[model samples]
Target: MAEEEKSIFFPDDSHKLWSFGDTRTYQRLSSNSSGFLRQLFIVNIVFWAAFLIYFVLTASQPFAVQPLLLAVLLLPSIFLSLYVLVALRSAERKRLKLRASGFIIYAPLSQDVFNEHCIDFDQVRSLRLALHKRHFLPEEECLIIERRDGRSLVIPFEEVLTDIRRSDFMARLSAYRPGLLDLSEAPALPGEGGPSFTELWLHDFATQGTRESLGLLPAGGSLKEGSYTVDGIIGGGGQGNAYLAEGPNGTVVLKEYVLPVYRGTRLFEDLSARFFAEAKLLSALDHRAIVKLLDHFVEDSRGYLVLEFVEGPSLKELVEKEGAQPLSTVISVGKDLSAALLYLHGRFPAVVHRDLSPDNVILREDGSACIVDFNVARELERDSRTAVVGKQAYMPPEQFRGKPCPQSDLYALGATLYFLAVGQDPPPLTNLSPFEDAAEARSKDPGFAEFDEIVRGLTRLNLEKRIRSADLVYEKLSRLALKRRES
Candidate 1:
């Protein structure tokens, strides 16, 4: 089409180009439009079959059908079905145009043209490319547009045509405004000029593979109707289990909660509600020091959470295998855990990790640490009736009484550092004075004196005497780290 004919507004409103300024336009149909047409056709056929059968069965003479009654029933059905097909066809051909300022979504055929279809670039918050999983069928790739107001639009890719157009659109969008979109969860294009539609599809196909080994559910069997393929079991408790699974994007840890209560009972409903609500809050957190909650759902009366798989060993396992780490390593790991706690406590509604211990902290190959297992974490609401939960060796006095605050995490952090230094779990439910425990090591290295002092303050029996917050702990650790490096 000529540049003069291209529309700055709706592509269907072509005449406006002549009166107003003209700009470039791109168009594509919504991929889901065909699915709607197919469903409508099926419903039309089923209704006709049912109506004919009922009329024949009720008739006085089986062979003699009244033409007037038949016409009354059949004509409207035929006309309405035709009208619906036409409307769906129109929607299938409707255009979505991308321009310099923003993009335009054509209104559905049944909706008014003035409906909210035009969206500016500024309104867009993120663009995530993810696969939409389907049962016993190929997963469909889609673009999820998250708006600033928490609304989102999911548009599935339309095979080759849509993929090609998307690559071009993304390129032009970047040229128009560099770094305007957050594509952290999106895959990279093949080359500097971007990949062809075929190349991109092929790359996606390679990553989404069928598991070759047996798991909790056989090699190919899945949970949540094939959304997640269980590869192996990672951990399990009496009430639940965790599986290493393959998700659409990549590897994930699928945590299961077996809610054994009867579905109709009030207890079952409350448990399900609380499980999903916490999942939502966990998903909102975006930080490297914490595990990310990717997706969540319930099936067969059991709740499941899809989490990012952090590839590393837990601090407990690392310490057990490697023995006591050096003072420098202890300080480094402490800082990472402290920063994670600071972030958790710093949220608008502060979060308390009721159970923080070496067992839940992972040490990655890159040498950074991240906190995991938020099953016992909760937003701080100062509820006196809060459940008492945590490892006995790491729990503070207040936490043991079911009153955990942000400072409780600090106490646990101190115990974790002691484990890293002493290579064994600290004595349960006691104020740790690690100086005596590490006295022999302190005699070898004077720095252990300072490290032990920090741990002592953090594990003080009285709340008033204990290290108050993650912020203060981080500052002290930072100075200790600097002093070690200078020496």
Candidate 2:
């Protein structure tokens, strides 16, 4: 093969790369090896028959007493069968173990290894999904990649090797790092990478000689199949139980709703509309400060969401712990929350977060705010909704009359700040009853002076009089914080 001829035959595009996965290798496992094993079993049965026949002949009258050659051959065959049986039992255990660790991608339809650059195992960091998952757990099913430098990169494995070829990854691995795997024997396609920590644990757990055992299933579950385990109970809404789950791959928020409860909702039509709509709203927004949706699934006959778990507390909790946050803190939170709303309101169908309370606002470790909980939120497609969405205390006067707008959210932010500083809901809203008529009633109470002005601005019975925008609120809050510091 001349170099020129080889170059002409294999041009650059002679083969292209595919990462999202192309189906070139997916096929049923061949039955030839199984047929061979069956034949071997038949051979063993025949040898056992021969041994019995020789014994019977010797026992019969006038039969030859000794058949030494038959004994010599029969003994070896018996021993060989025993050895093979032991080897097979061990192989089954390993197969089951590998299946438990992660999704066993049964070699995509196109299972050719694209080995343009041979990987060095020692240089590999954790392999991860390029695109964060929307409906499926990406962390569990992603490609195992290696990086020589701090920069991460995934190798296009499918186009280079055949999945069923079994020794392809092992051969490639050993060529780079001899004796990479613990066993003297090389690994199959899925197990080609030197035994990972997860793989090792799976092996130990899977092969353990015990009374009961478990196997891998989907991250999300259906009534027929249960899902992965839940590790933490994070938050719960009226719809379902929200939990932090130990995903087969990574950290996920498991939203488990009782089956019978879901089928019996009065808001069935509206709930279904909002349920999928929430997922859609989350998928559309890609801003950094906003919470990201990693994946979601309906499992164990219930629904769950895999969210990027931010390690911090919510603004409500912050206010609770500190009694009241400085005005500066409120402004910073308001800015982020408002920006998110602006994005939501401008979206195609227009997302309206009906519940805009502090409890739903999470404060990141870096002191940034993120608004969450769109469970009760409604969408107005082309603008038309007679109904309203918001807590009574935070709702503007127009809302009580069954009308709300973007200004309603700003009013809520004001009420939240007043509550944080004054340690009470607005006096007017709280005292909508006959006895406590208005601010005059609240002003008479001890410790009322400190919050009188703040409460007045928030408790404006008229929506027209409430804080109109987050921009205005941000500026006022910054000024208050500055004044407080100087005094």
Candidate 3:
């Protein structure tokens, strides 16, 4: 941890971002909360009501209450009230800067954020805190600050009260004015020229979004033999868990779609068909780097797809556990990846793995890359095409306008390589969330000029301007690998 700090930096953390809590056991209230939000509820109601009445009575236009104006005022007030009442309820994330030790990082979300980028957290006076009055309330409170920035980060103190370890965190923070030493292991590297790693983490300390209250996991009961036995859970996304399961005589991976009833049946069926269709399409093709589809089934009124289960860690896991891998791992993985794409694209009706991120690719025990989660939207009926099946960030711009093709897959591939080269996820295309992860990653480690150049060629926002094909990516990567080997 200390070694990584030397090579990293963090932006000022004066401003705070979102917060959450775990219900320890999935109850309506997350366990990390302190119920401070409930207290804030009474306080906010009384304060807002008092001021709102006074303002309405004296205002020239009265309580204009337009959605737009009301929205603007309520937004900050909500954040403020949450900070005021729910002390340490929410965890504050620096949108721009981070504070170092002894000193507070002063990166502001709205103004002069760049100034706080390089400042050391050690030099700052205090850090921010997310406070809440209750476990269920969405509002938060702001308590700690090097000085006074008018905002606090989120921290679930109420629910944490019951957790001995979490309660210890509170006790530790109490000793230091700003709070306990920040505890994030992620490099403080804030993308751009921000505070050094040590400085940024100086104020890093937070609680889990939810507090686990004694009992959360289901009783460890063995079930009678069933059709399938779940193996290792590989990963999860908007879809569901990707588990290695065994059925009949062979091993396979199954992806189940768990969703809220509100998503509508149309969306679920559409996703299921698309998944099956993609598997079927992939099944028809044989590629060294691609996982094969053995069979698919639907029973018990549930949706699930089965495919070959390749063993080994994912590219993302490798990076997190062991920084950047040798170019050999990169090239070997890249070669298999490109070969599979080449085969898929050459098909009479080309296939596209629209969401090609590290999480979707696995490093097999045989030293090859196996692609997963290729979307088969084309296989679906026209009615289901608009349901949105791919991971937005890895998708090309064309996808945003409702287009999926081979080129779209290449966009994902390019993004995948960029992530490999930089050790970070790319920016997302979906609007449901924000903050481009790819851009932030690149800023963190530009690497060599050639490497940076490669990332640029692959991840261009403009499809036309981006590297044209799988073959081209392979060719460039081959040359890059050869050059690195010689050097």
Leading candidate by lDDT: 1
**Tens-digit per-residue lDDT, 1-487, candidate 2:** 1012111112222243322221111122321234334646776998778767877777665356456856777779967876765444322211100110111222211112211222334544544323222222242222344344775433223322322122423322332233333432212345345643222222222232332212322334322133446565666655566776665566656554332222212243244334445655666677655677766554333334456666678767786787655545655665677667667666666656667777777888888887756666655532233466577777776666555566666666656656555445554254122113235434443333433454355446676676555555555545554565676
Whole-model lDDT, model 1: 0.69
RMSD of each: 22.7, 26.1, 22.4
Which regions of candidate 1 are displaced past 4 Å?
Answer: 1-216, 266-270
lDDT of 1 at 442: 72
Q: Quick one: best TM-score, which candidate?
A: 1
- The candidate 3 region of ten consecutive residues with least summed lDDT is 21-30
Better of 2 and 3 by TM-score: 3
Per-residue C-alpha lDDT of model 1 across residues 11-58, encoded as one tens digit per residue = 333232112222232332322334444656776898788887886899
lDDT of 2 at 331: 50
User: In order, what lDDT does every prediction score?
Assistant: 0.69, 0.48, 0.51
- How many clashes does each candidate structure show, in the order listed? 0, 20, 88
Quote the positional error of residue 134 for candidate 2 in Å.
41
Residue 209 shift from truth in candidate 3, angstroms? 39
